[model samples]
Structure formats: structure tokens, C-alpha cells
Target chain A: MKPMLAALVLLASLGVPLLAVAADPLASPGWPIAQNRFLTGKTYVFDDRVQVIVPRDAEDSTAVPGFVRVQGIPDVQQIMVFAELNPIPMIVQFWPHRLEPNIGFRFKVQQATPVRAAALGADGIWYIGGAWVNAAGGGCSAPSIASADADWAERLGEVHSRIWNRGDEGRRLRLTVMHPMDTGLAAGIPKFYLEELVLVDDADKHLGRVEVHASVAENPTLTFDLRTGGSVRIQGADNNGNRMLGEVE
Target chain B: MMPRLNALLGFYALLYGSFAAALDYQLQPREIAAGVYIFEGRQEHFTRHNGGNIVNTGFVITDAGVVVIDTGPSRLYGEQMRKAIATVTDQPPVQVFITHHHPDHFLGNQAFADVPICALPLTQKIIARDADALLDNMYRAAGAWMEGTEAVAPNCRAEAGKLTVGERRLSVLAVAGHSGDEASDLMVYDHRSGTLFAGDIVFHGRAATTPHANIQVWLQVLRDLERQQPQILVPGHGPTATDSRAIRETAAYLEWLDTTLREAAAAGLDMAEALELEIPERFKSLAVIDEEFERSVFHLFPAIDQEVLHGGAGNGTR
Candidate 1:
């Protein structure tokens, strides 16, 4: 071996510290770094039970539908979604307080990348699942249709939400809010997006909470499965401190 | 010395051959009227084979100079279009009127830099703001054909009134809705030849792209154009026609698209489900209809869904 290689091998034998190599299931260059950042100092396993469902190809990079459903896990507390190669890699972090471990939302994909979902179970284990999404890219930086309108600010924080009862499949609530969700990557646009959103039952009990990022699409849509059919209120605040409030029956 | 001369000749031949093969649009201008000629483009989408030349471009030779309408998709196309105009008429081009701010229609503005390139005031603004992104899209779709191509903003504004270019009295109309909210589609009517250049407002056989379209308003604009009733019509795409068939065809397709999207939204179909919906048999003959339909769905669905599902109130004000 070369002298440099011999020296490195000798250092390794002497227990020199080096970055641990991670075996990423999707074989993405961004996965190791993203994993380290999002799940810092936390151990994770590639679990098939932690399901991440997304289209094989994003027909529209600006709003690609994605869902995460955790099965075979009895006690799931937290869930996080990541698009490993997006400029903003962490798409969302959810806390299912009284709701099921299922979420459906649309997010931007800057390029073809690995989309991952990690469910933190009551056992303190991070179970991860992921899929590859092919894309034409530029989702994060493209100016949204809302940004072009002169009066988009007048209608800002407008929320439209609906509930559907699927009986055996459980209840679903879909909420859409009007916001630019700008990543600020485009020229002459500032970063603005919903920072946190919480769903509350009629009794003011927290059903679920989601921390959103700019990686979400403009006019973000968040769908969730409810444990029971009842009226709920959504309260949110954007990075610019704009209040997004709505109620759905 | 003889050997060196032969090598030099070989080098020139190779250079000529490569240039000929790579950037040749093979533009053929067909005269539709007296002093009015059109270089009809192919019906295919932007590809390396077609070099983004999928839109019709034409010119009118007036007593004083040549008035060009709509440059093609790339810098090479614009350069070649200038050369082709030279072959047809000796008059230097005095003015260039861009039909709309779409990349295919105005990426060639660089070729007419010396001429006063004109467009609607709004079209100029939209082009200036969105030109970079649109040009980037052209590069992605057309590849190497866009080499050295840059988005050149229109230099002058074509106001909504009669313009006397040389001896030709042309009526310039500023219309909207065919292109999106921020665009103003420009149509020019030649009083002498009785020919109306209906920009993207009229697509003959090809499907209309709706990345920036408001269909209801677009239909109303079509009705306004039909009332003018020019003897000859030069559509933005497809063959030049002497009748109003192009206008009717464009309106019919847009009407169908509008109804389809509304019904799909009313039925609460998701974007993916709407994309999978079938197209009628009549529209199957239109070139690139499927791709355009999907693109329209992507552009129009989310807004339509909100309108149809929740009575058009985008939530509530803060």
C-alpha cells in the first residue's frame, strides 16, 4: 500500500476516530448527512413496517403526494418525513397525540431523491422506510402561482378543510391553506411558510401537530386520519407570524 | 505548401458540414397573400430533432421595409430566420412584434436586436420577469439547440391601436386570457391583405398549452376575434387558413378542456385521478394532445378544486 494508506490503516488499528459509514438502503449520497442531522445521536433501523408511499415519478415537482403509514408498531409517538436531496431536506415532523400514525401531504421535490419516513416508537427506536422519486426538479426554487398575483397577500392564510367518513377505513380530514410557502431560493422573493400547525378537538385537546417547512408545496395540503368523527379546529402560524386559523365540521 | 493547402480546405469542409447538420431549421416561407409569407413550424413538441421550432413565424413585406411577426424558439432559429427573410425580400426588417411572451415565440429576440422588438406593455414585463425561467425550461426541453440562446426582453411597446409600418396600416389588438393573468396576447391585422395574425389565441390542429390560461376569458376573447372576421387567418400553430375553422377548432378544444376540468373537480377527483381520465376520440388526432392535457390538468386542477369544493372563498382573511 502507499505510505498515506499505510498510515491511515495504522491509525485505524490505534482506534483513531472516523465518521461511521452508514449503509443507506436507497444508496443516496445525501442520506447519511441528513440522517445524522435529523436523527442526531439516535440509532435507526430500516424497517419495512414503517411505510413511505409516494409515486414512482413526480408528474409535478411542485406538489408530489406522499403518505406515511406505520403498521405493526403498537406505540408510535413521533414521525418525520425527509426528501434527502431537497434544498430543505426535512419536509415535516409530526406528533400524533391522539391520532393514528398516518399522514398524507404534498411536498416539493427539487430533484429525484430518496423520500424517507421515520417513526419513533414507544420503545425509543427510530424505524425508517423510504422510496425513490424521479423528478424534473426545480420545485424548491420555482416561483409559485400565488407569488405572481398582486393581491395574493390579501387572501393570505385562507384555509379550506373538509372531512370524509370512510367507515371501516376511518375518518379523513384534508386541509388546504393559501400561502406562498416560498423557499426564498428564487430571486426577489423572501422566505415565507407555515412553521407549525396543530389540530384540536372540540374540547380543545390536541389531536395532532405538524411542524412544516418550506419544502412543502404552495397552498399546502395536509391530510390526516382521525380516531373519531367530530368537529376540529386548525391553528397555525407562519414564519412571518401570519395566523392561519380555520374550523371544519 | 500544396499539402498544407489541401489540409486547410479539408478543415473548412468539416466545419461547414457540422454547422449544416446541427442548426439547420430548413425554414421554407410560403406566401399566403401578396407580400405576406409564413414559415410554418412542425407540430411536434420541442425536441433535439425539431430544435424547439414548433410555432409558426411569418413576415410581411411593406413598401418601406419588412415587418416580422414572432421569432422562433432559439438564437439559431432567430439568426436563420433573419437569413431566410433576406432570401425572400431585400427590405431590411424595420420592426418585430412578439405574439406573446412564451419562450418559443420570443427566444429569438436576440436575432432581431438591431430591429425595434415590440410587444404589449404587460407582455414585455412578463417576459422580462419570467424570461430566465422560461429560457431554462427551453434548454431542458430542446437541449443543445439552445446553445448561446438568451432571453432578450422586447425593446419597445406595441400599443393597442393602428400602426402604420411603412405603407401598411396594421391594427394592433391587445387581448388577454389566452396566456395567463399576467399576459396580454397581441394580434396584428393587415388591412391591405385582410390577414389577421392570431397569436396563441388560435391553435389550428395542435393542442393549446395552458400553463398560464384562464379558459372562460380566453373563450370570450375568441368570440371578439371572430367578430372581426379577417379574410385570411394566420394561427400561432398549424396551417394558415382562409376561413374561420382555426378559430372554431381552438375554441372547441378549450371549451372541452374547461368542462372536463370543472366536472372532474366537481366529482372530487384528485389530481392523479384526473390525469388518468380519458380524452374524447375527436381530440385524439391533435398532435401532443395527451401531454398538453396532462400539463393543463397540473396547472388548473388545484385552483378548480378549491373553487368547486368550497364556493371560491380561499379560507378567510387574517
Candidate 2:
């Protein structure tokens, strides 16, 4: 019985340290973990032959990091990513996959978060890669052009989309909207936000939707995947009785 | 495993803390030149506040009227510029010249609609298509900074070409590559003082931010401006640099950027590696150099590489 008691005490002692460690909220997770969630809906898969490149230390633009080679994509159609909370959360997504397996673009990052890149391969698989940015400030929530709200109201229906045809059944489409997509965080003259609901549809079918927080950038430019030669349409409506429409060519 | 978790937690704490402290820095406008003024816009280091100082608008008080060059960021700012001008001059500006089509430079044009606004033909097209977006950006940006100010699209419009205002003869040079329809030029050739307002074409202090910039054409334009050798050169930003030395300094910075980027491209350096390089010593004193310099370099390197790859002459128009 005495030996049993000692064993129980020992077990309790070991368990106490584990509990202490678990209770510490400040513990670090070694590998960079993305706080942003992976979007699951229609999957876009592409070839791994392409490479995604950006600045390593974005803050210190002088330090150029190496290009991250993307693999496992079948046929790259649209390669892009979006900051869920950036002024323009749709960071960048290229359409009609180019022949050169690699492309580069420079973007203003706001804070340290996981940056996810989605690639739609020729095989129609949506593959994603993510990286952590040390960027701190977000540009989407910042002030937009002063006359943005009024102009957005006037030209809200002027929707335009351009599609680039890549040979061999591959295509890219770039869609832009004139919406003030106020994130409900800004304080204006009368102390109100330009609240609105925006939607993207392909042939009257909903592809993706965003519940825009105040962080979406002004004049949101979204580039996404549509099979080459596929016809699409986009529409947007604001809570303030504003609406915009666009047709893909 | 514990160490990795600790590191991750440390990073998160730092990030969240910094984000919470991302307050809007006040944008201060300073009179950088004699007849030239610059509204150095606010730059939010961490948050979603990205709009900084827009175009540098200045006026030369000629005997007949004032020659206003470029407009502010929005129609509201344009109104502010007008009010600012009213304080200095009795008569309103008769002729306005757009230095470029960038929103900050020309978006506020509507306030000056009554005046004969002029710009390159390409600038007109860009403004027509992008005016709404420009105004949206201005409003969103101003709401984040100053109180009660709102962004308004400019109604004033103009076309690109050569024009004369009173005794001041101006030439609109179609300089592309920075933006789709960017027009830089030699405005107001004052025979009296011999000052040439080289808007964005001549960046006196450190390198200018070139996100939508065409490095090759921008460099060539700098060389062309240097060839002209105006006595007093007023840049788009920074203090008015007197003499040809400012022109030389601007040229030297471009040359250095060209050389450095060329070497990096040849070395097969990626964007990240290229950005890591140390900036030259000459630009240390300039404000926001550390923050904006790398972005400038990253933009120029690939742009220069693409220009070389196309086998196009570095000095091609636009």
C-alpha cells in the first residue's frame, strides 16, 4: 500500500507540470500557423510548375527573398490570393495562366498573418499555399479617395470584366467593381458608413461571396477562375439602396 | 515542441500589439518650394491606411494669372487647394496643367473646372475611366485622417497637348511606363526666373515610389530633363532643389537603381533577395527612405528586366 501511494504521488507530480504548461497561454507555436481559414467551395487546382514570388521582409523592402516554387498544380489557370481583411482583400489572382511557369507582383501588406495562394490547375484541382507576413498595418480599412462614396453611388452599375484566353482551353478573367464597400468602421461627416453587399456570379450562378468588414479596400479588384471561354456575370447591391452589374466577355 | 509553440505565441503577441497601436499618423502639408506647395499625406505603417501624400500642386503667380500645376487628391482637397490659393492670390488660376493622371495629381480637377484644364490625351482617358475609383479612394482615405472631409470626384476635365498660359509657355510630355497614362512635362518655362516645374519626372531627394512605374522610360525622361538643364528645378515632392545639381542628383539615383537592379536580375536574384540589399549611403537622410525605398527597388527591378527582355530600347517613348 505504501508503494502504491508513492506511485500515485509521482504520477500526480508529473501531471502537475503538464497542466502548468497547458495553462500557460503565452506558449509559442514553432511553425508558422495561419489564423485565416482555407476557403472551401469550388476547388481550383493547377500545375506545380509555377512559382509565386514576393518580398521576403516586406517591411524592409531592401531584403529580397527567394521565389517560392509552387508544385503539384496540373494546368495553372488563375493563381491568386486574398487578404480576408485587407482594404482590398482580393490581393491578386492572375487569369488565363501564362506560359512562363512563374509570375511576380508587389502588394501592400497590413499586418503579420497567413497569406494564402490558390492555384487552379489544368486538371481542375484547387491547390493552396500559404505564408506568414510580418506586415502590421492594413490598407483596406484606411481612408479611400474622398469622393469615393458619391462616385460609387453614381457609377455603381458600371460593371466591367476582361477575360484573357490562354491557348489550350485555358483562360483568365479580371473583374472590377465600383463599390464603396464600407467596413462599418469609418466615421464620416454624418457619422455613417457606406454599407453594401457585393456578389460575384458565373452565368447567374453564385461563385463566391464576401461579408465585407470595414477592411475591404476601396475599388475592390477581384481576379478569379473561370474555364477559358466560359461566360460569366457579376452583380453587387449596397444596403444603402445602391446596385452595380457587370457581364464577362 | 514547447520552444516552437513559445515562438509562435511571441510572434502573435507582437503582431496583435503592433496592430492595436497602429494609430493614424497626422498628414502635414509643408510649403516645399517658393511658389510650389506639397501636402505630404499620411502613411499608416501597419493598418489598412495606405493613401499618403497625393500630387504636389503648385502655382506660379504670373503677371496675367496663376499657372496651377496638378491638382490635390480629391475634389474636396481640390477645394482646399483652391481656398489655399485664394489666400495667396487675388485672381483665381486661369490655366491648370495636369502633371500626370495619378489620382492624387489630377482627381481634384473638378474644383478647378471653370479653368482651362489641360493634360496629355492619355491622361484624359485615364481620368474618365478612373475618376470614380479615384474619388472613392480619396473619401475613404480622408475619413481615416482628417475630420468631416469627404472625397468628391472632380468634374473639371482636360486633354493632353501643348498650351500657353499668358506669358508662360508649357509643353506636355507624354511620359508613360509609370502608369498606363502618366503624363509628365516641363510646365511654365519662366523666362524671368527660368524655373521649370518637372512634376514627378524629377524626384530630388531619395527615389520616388514606383509601384506602377516604368523604370526604363522614367530613367530616360530623367536624362532628357537633365539635358534641358533648367536653372531652378521644382520637383513633385521635397524642397525645391535649385540649380542643375538637383537634376544631377535625381539622375544619379535613377542610374544607381538601374545598375543595382540590372546586376540583381543578371545574378538571378529573386524579389526577396533583391530587396534585402543595403541602400546606398547618399539616401540615408531622406524621410521614409527605409520604408519606401525597398518597394521602389522591387518595382524597378522586374520592370527593368521586362524592358530588357522585350529587347526594347530603354529610352523608348512610354
Candidate 3:
């Protein structure tokens, strides 16, 4: 008991989620057991309010599609996605000005990794959602299409949004932005992509959001699980001063 | 365990489609001219949703039987095309003409196995060479749509000349400059109806794909095609055009792309800078313009840059 207490004190001082890991030794690595800038030192309870969708076997490693949803939370300010296997790790770090609900997006999954999404609330607590993405080869270094292609600039900043009721009392919202989420791995290619995405309801109610990473595929896509069904408003920004707003009924 | 579960679910979906809803390949062709019928495919890229049905395929009913212009993207599309043709005319397609070696032009040859699917010898050779890689990419882009699709090479050789089909005289010519399969992309000029079944050589509304285009040579081919002065020109991808002015539209685009890529390469702008280069406002209205231009620049611009500046023997993704 003395040793355990000492370890807890050490972990608390280190600002890690080691206490959560210590509470359940059998917990998966995805159960928030590491240090995060937004999640460190904050008392966060494990809640199903945040959910994620990851493909078990992604056919195209370069564009592994996934979705993250955050609901039943108030005043959410930011969200971040991290792929454990990526060389750079954090896929996206979003600072959405509008409180939009959820996002479905594609990731440049380098290899098989435990991908996690962390949502930061106004109360300084981060809710986490995670899944495992299995891929055969490297999605990061495969001569990404964003930087190598010359016509990406003309098509940049175009946004397409769609909303559909899953019919299981849950609605889904998907948004695709035409921007090369460059990971800066390729020679001569700069790190350019959507940095943040925010979702809001018809009443301008703040919902779930996420920050994007360069590991995201070109023409970034975001899908979200909507707890409440109605008109949805999406807002996102990129490394370039490009802001796009979309509405889906 | 997850993949196993997914595999099991896929098996069940295959066995019992009623449990899970899937895409239905319902193809219906519309008659554009007398005997020349065209199927306007979905105006989208090859994806899981579109199921690879993104190529314009037409069929002409001759006195002997039906002559198909180009098979679609997959065996399923070709099979459905056969069924669609049966609804229009009872005669089966005697000769299936593959316009080029593009998968959209040949992969559906499996559906017309009984018929003599004909193409240029070079086209056949390139298709034979790139069959495996092409099918692999197609399967990756379209999962279930390529289930039964197999790469079936064109068994019959089609020559450049007036082909006598029963009573109709159809003049077949080669137009090579659009893509890699040089001298393989063929055009069929119907003398009776004044319709030109122009393959990938001419893109009307869609931004032409320029993966292996010799733009200068392509320009020359367009001028020659315009000289034919066909009443209707059915392009490989988009809607059919009635006037020869469509040829100029395609030529202008190719010339612009060639000039832009050369200029960018000469200006020491790398592929990254070239990608960010401004697209002229005129080509913005073309269908799939963004995606098409990006793909062309990715595959072509860097090589042009190297050939012009670096003196390196650049590699072009074939």
C-alpha cells in the first residue's frame, strides 16, 4: 500500500494517466494510459459519451477512414486524434471556434496502431475514444498524393457535407474538405492541411470537434455520430488561412 | 479476431444479401442516334459507392448483330450491359470494340467472352502487360464491384479501315496521343450516320486524364478528328457532342496543360509549387477538373520539371 501510494504520487507529479492504468491492470493500452497535453492532471471519468469507428482491415493504408463522436458534453473546445504507430503520432489537433458535434475523417495510418481521439471540454477534462486500425504496410511514406500533385491548390478549400439518420435513433454527419493534409514526410512538400474542425447544431449548440494532422489523407474527410438528429452546421480551418462552413439537413 | 469476424460477415452478406443492403448494378442505355446507344455512367470517381461505373459505353445495332463500343469498368458492369442490350435488341453483340487499354475500356470484356472482343494489337499488348496491377488497383478502389471481374484480353485484332458489318460500313481509325497505350486507342467513324465514336482522345466536359499524354501529338490527332466533321462525337467519358467544336475544347485544354506544366518545370518550381500553381479560370467548369488536374500533375509535372531542369532520367508512373 505504501509503494502504491508512492507510485500514484509519482504519476500525479508526472501528469500521466498512470493512475487510471493502475486501477485496472487488464485495461487495454487504448484506455488512456499515457500523457497528453490537454488530458494531463485532469480528473476525467470514463464515459461512453465519446465513441470512435475504426476499420479493422483498411484496404488503402493511405486513406484509412474513421469517425469520432462526442455527445452529452457541454462547452467542448478542442479534440485531438493520435495514431500510436505514426512517426509524428498526433494526427490532428483541432481548435474549432464553433461548438460542432462530431467528425468523420480519414487518417494516413502509417501502420497498424491504436488510434485514439481526445475531446477537451470547457471544464478542462478530456474524453477519449479509441480503436485499432490494422494495415499491411506504411501509409505515411508511400509518396503521398498531396505534395506530389501540382493541382491541389485550385481545388483547395472546397467542402462537401452530408447528414443521414442511421435509423437506430442515431444520425451521422460526414464532411469532406478538398485540401491536401500534407504530412511533410515527402521532400519539398510542406505541412498543409485542415488544422481544426468544429460542429454545431441548428441552435448553434456546440458539439464535438477535432484537430487534424498531416497524417490525414488528402481531401480530408470527417464523419461524426450525432446523438441528436436535426440540421447540422460544420466549420473547419486549415494551415492556410482557409475557412469553410457547411450545413447538412 | 476482428478481421475474422469481418470475413465471416462478408461471407454471410455474400450468401444472404437480404440481411445487408448492398449496391445494385442497374444499367440502362439511352439511344442517342439510330442504332448508336450510350449509357451515361454516374459522374463520379471509382469508389465503393459508385462501384466503378464511371465510363461511357455505347452499343450499335448493325444488320448482322450488335457491336459494342467499349465495355465498362468491371465484369459486373459488362454482364449488366449485356442484359441492358438484350432489352433493346434481341441480337447479341458480335464484335465488342475496346477503345483502349484502360480498365474501364477492357475489364468488362469478361462479360462478352462469347463475342470477339477486338482492340489494336498494341492496346492488347499493354493490357496484357498491366493487367495484374490494373486489376489490383480496381479491386482496391471497388471492393465488391470487382468480385467476379477478371482481366480478359482482347482475343480478336481490329484493323484500321472500313469494317463491313453486314451492310453498314464503319471506318475504324487509331488515335493514340491521349494515354500510354500509344497507337491503341481507336476511333470508329460511322459514315452512314456521321457519328464519331471518339475514345479517350477527346474529353468534352470532363477534364481529360493526362497520365501518358503526348500533348503535341494529341493536339495533332484532335485536328485530324475535327477534319472528319462528324455530326455526333461520343467521347470516352462525358456526354456526346453534335458539333466538331468539341474537338477544339479538348485541344485547348491539352495545350494549356502542356504549356503550364512546361512553364512550371522551366521556372524551377518543384512538384509542390507546381501543385499550388493557379489553374486558369476557364478549365474550372470541367467535370472532375480538380481531381483530374491533380492526378495529371502528380504523374506528369515532376518528370517534365526534371527533363527540363535537372537532366535526370525521371520516372513516370505508368
Candidate 4:
């Protein structure tokens, strides 16, 4: 008990928050718990350079668009995004090997909550960024429209993609694939969604991969910035092992 | 005693002004052309303050009877509109034409139940399927104003081409894209007055609602209407116009919305970012521009983004 009190005094002297692993910039109540669950004793700091963009008012709660840019932190090994208050809080994880650490995605928000991104740097520290996304609620529990379609099975794994020129910035790749991305919160619906999307160059060299989750909107559309241009292949599979492949220049 | 009576009169006046005036729709019809009168609602979105009277309803008094074009938003509004029309003419409403299935245009079917309430076949079907949900939304939006209002489906089909009722030579034209479906919008051109009732297809001053709009199709319909060159144009919302300015304004707003969404998509701006994009200064004068623009972005940006991503030929939205 003496040692614990001493440690608390030391933390207080250092101005470290007793609750959170690090001070949350967004002041989310669930940030401390999220840090414990995701980081789990890993060192991290709240960084403004890791920008997370979201609308102040989300009209369509089911398809709230989000973008994260981790260009401020170099040598990022992996990045994970989540909504703090969602039933299924985890959204996606990206292992951007050779691609830029910038990604855009549509996510489901059960309520107005903090949406965040944590980038794991090579130095073994997690850098976090987040923003408050206001919504009308009930997005996660509502079953996706694709789940209601009788012929959704036939349309599964279909992909549409395009690559646009960004001049000096980088090439932008936007793509959407047919999947329900069911969160399973709705009654009678089971959890099902794409688990991985692997981006490959024309030479069959792997560039990066995005691990999707049930918190993503149905028929998820994703946008990414790549350092290089040329035709690229997008190969993906759902949790049930259904696979799809598409190409874009 | 005289002072007390005056005080009592003042108290009653204040009470009437506060409660009764607020509750009443107080519809007044303005004669835009010979035999054609239009009740222009306030250019505002539905609110408890305004009820759902943000739409224009008109009637043409002819030798046979009155031809009512598009009933107002709710049953109360419909009842009030009928009373207002009676002040000008003793003839009852013989035929009711619903321009489309939008709640503000057709939800007043109860007032005109005795008459043949007509709409496009598709419009009638859509109203049958969606009116209840639309009415529920109105209740949520306008609160007590929508009390006791029930959605009544159109009982008669309004066909395109010449429609003669009494002495009024009406050309019923079928249009679409405003309601976001094929052959859903119906426009009436009165040959006698040269007045055109352009339903929700045209809006003056107020920003257009695009929940079910196809921008390209809407533009084409507008162009066709411009060619008609009616003497007076009564839009579904805002003031009645003598020229084609309403038609042009609606076209311009739709075009700007279309272009803005397309460019934002091509630029890789997400929907959230697109919502933050600035509205042009010229369109700033339009009523509810900011809210309507936000709604339009939410309703449309996904398809436009998909289109840009697919290089224009992809099937947009399931």
C-alpha cells in the first residue's frame, strides 16, 4: 500500500492522468478503457499530427465517412480505427507496408461518439488521433440494407474500382465491394463482413492490406492514397472465406 | 365598467392572437391569372410554427366547377384551403389533381374525398406505399399541426395529354426525376389561363429537396417546361411567378448541386468533407439552403463518388 501510494504521488507530480494511459484530446469517457483494450501496456501519446476527420453532424448514421492521415508519423507499422461507443467498437486495421498511411472509410455509429485512429510506429509507440462524430444513434444495431436483399448472395464479392491522378500529391484509389458488413446487433442477424483486402502491384508484389470489421457500413467504399501509380489488383475475402478480385489503373 | 370591458376585450384579443392564430393556417388564395388562383405558402421548411404549409396549392374556377390542383400538406390545411376557395366561388371542387406523391402535395386527400382525386398511376402507387411513412415523418416534424391527419390515396389515375374539365382546357403532362422515379411527376398546363402548375418539379426562392431526385432527368424536364413558356408559373413552393424564372432557378440549383457533388467526388473528398464545402454566394439567398444542401450531399454524394470511382458507367447505389 505504501508503494502504491508513492507511485500515485509520482504520477501526480509528473501530471499524468490516473485514468487514461495518456491524456485523450477528444476527452472521451471510454478512451481509457479503449487504450487498455487495444494498447494493453504499450506506450502511446496523443498526437494532433495524426488527423482523424469526421462530420460534426452525421445525417446518415449508418454510413458516416471517416478519414485518417498518419503522414506526420514516419515508420508506422500498423494502424487501427474504432468508434468508442459502438457495440462493435473496432472498425478496421491497416498494415500499410509500401502504401501511404492515409485511408478513407465509411463506418456505422450507434451514437454520437469519438472515432479514433492509433498508429503503431516502428519505435514501439502508439500515436493516437480522434474526433467527435455526432449522430442520431441506432446505426450499429440496424441491419444493413444488403442483408434484406434476396439475391445478395449472388452479388457478393463484386468490386468496382478507379484510380485517379493527384499530380504531385499521390494517386488516389477508391473502391467499393458488395458485402453486407452486418454488425449482428440487429435481432436474427449474424455477424458477417470482409476481414481482409490485400492491395498488390501489377508485378504481384504486395503493397498493403486493410482488415475490415462489422462496424463498417454495408457495401463498404474505401479510398486510399498510394505513392506509386500503375494498374493495381485488389484481392479480398470475407470472414466466411468468400474471395473477390478486381483491377484498376 | 367601460374600462373593465375594454380590458376584457384586450385580454381576449391577446388570447386569440397567441393561441388561435398560431393554430390556424389562415390560407388566402391569390388570383394569378383569369379564373386561376394560387395559395402561396410561406417559404420555409416544415416546423411546428408553420405546420406543413410550405407548398403551393391552386384551383381554376371554370363553368363546370373548380379544378383543384394539388391539395396542401395536412387534412387541416386541406379543410382550410377549401374554405378559402369558397370565398371566391360558390362552385365545389369537381376534380383534384395531385402533381406527385410527396406528402405536401397529396396528403390532403381527405378534404377532396368527394371529388375524384387524380394523380399519375405511378404516383398513386408510390403514395399508397409511402404516404403513411411520410405522414409519420410530418407528425414528427410538425407536431400538433399533423394531429388527426390521415394519408388518403388518390382514387383516380391522371393520364398525360389533353384533359378537359368544364370550360378549362387542361393539358396533363407526365414528368419524372423530381420524385426519383419514372413517370411520377404530373404537370398541368391550363390552356384558358396559360397557367402552369409545376408541382415539386419547380421551386422559387426556396432550395429544392432531392430525396428522390435524378438530377439529369430533372434538368431535362425543366428544359421542356421552359419551352412551354406559361403566362404564370405556380411552383410547389415559394411565390407564384409570371415568367419562367422559377423553372430556371430550380434548374440552376440542381445543376450546381450536381456539379458540386461530382467535383467533390473526383477530388476525393469524403461525404463528411463534402458537407463542409461552402455553398456558392448566388445560392445563399435561397431559403433553407444550408439544410437542403446538407441533405442533398447525404442523399447524392455516395452515388456521385461511386460514379467518379467507376469512371462514370458504374451502376450507382443498389
DockQ of each: 0.14, 0.14, 0.02, 0.41
Q: Candidate 4, A47: how far from true, in Å?
A: 6.5
Best by lDDT: 4
DockQ value of candidate 1: 0.14
Q: Rank the candidates by TM-score, best first.
A: 4, 1, 3, 2
**Least lDDT summed over 10 consecutive residues: which range in candidate 1 chain A?**
A14-23
lDDT of each: 0.85, 0.52, 0.73, 0.86
lDDT per residue as tens, model 1, A74-187: 878999999989999989999998888988778999999999999999988788999898887989999988899999998799888887676677777778888999998889
The top-ranked prediction according to TM-score is 4
Candidate by candidate, in order, the iRMS in Å equals 3.7, 9.3, 16.3, 1.9
lDDT of 4 by residue, A1-249 (tens): 899778877897887655343457788889777877887767788888788888776768889888888866888898999998888898999999988898889999988899999999998878888999877677899888988889999989899898878777778888999899988799999989998999999988888999999999998899888877678999999989899999998
- Tell me the deviation in Å of residue B68 in model 1: 1.0
Top DockQ hit: 4
Chain B TM, per prediction? 0.91, 0.70, 0.90, 0.92
* lDDT tens per residue, model 2, A23-89: 1121223211212233333433222344444443454211123233455555556555554434444
**Which window of 10 residues has the lowest lDDT sum in candidate 1 chain B?**
B309-318
Predicted structure 4: lDDT = 0.86
Residue-wise C-alpha lDDT for candidate 2, range B79-162, written one tens digit per residue: 677777777667668877776666667666667878877766566666676665555545545444233333323334444355
Fnat computed for model 3:
0.00
Please, what are the lDDT tens digits per residue for candidate 3 over residues B1-318?
Answer: 999999999998786674235555678888888888988776667888777888888888888999899998898889888999999998888998888888877888988999998999988888888898779778877878788888888999889998888777898897688775357678887777877889888887888887567777788889987886789898887888998766888998888888887776554433434445677899888888777776676456545643543234444322
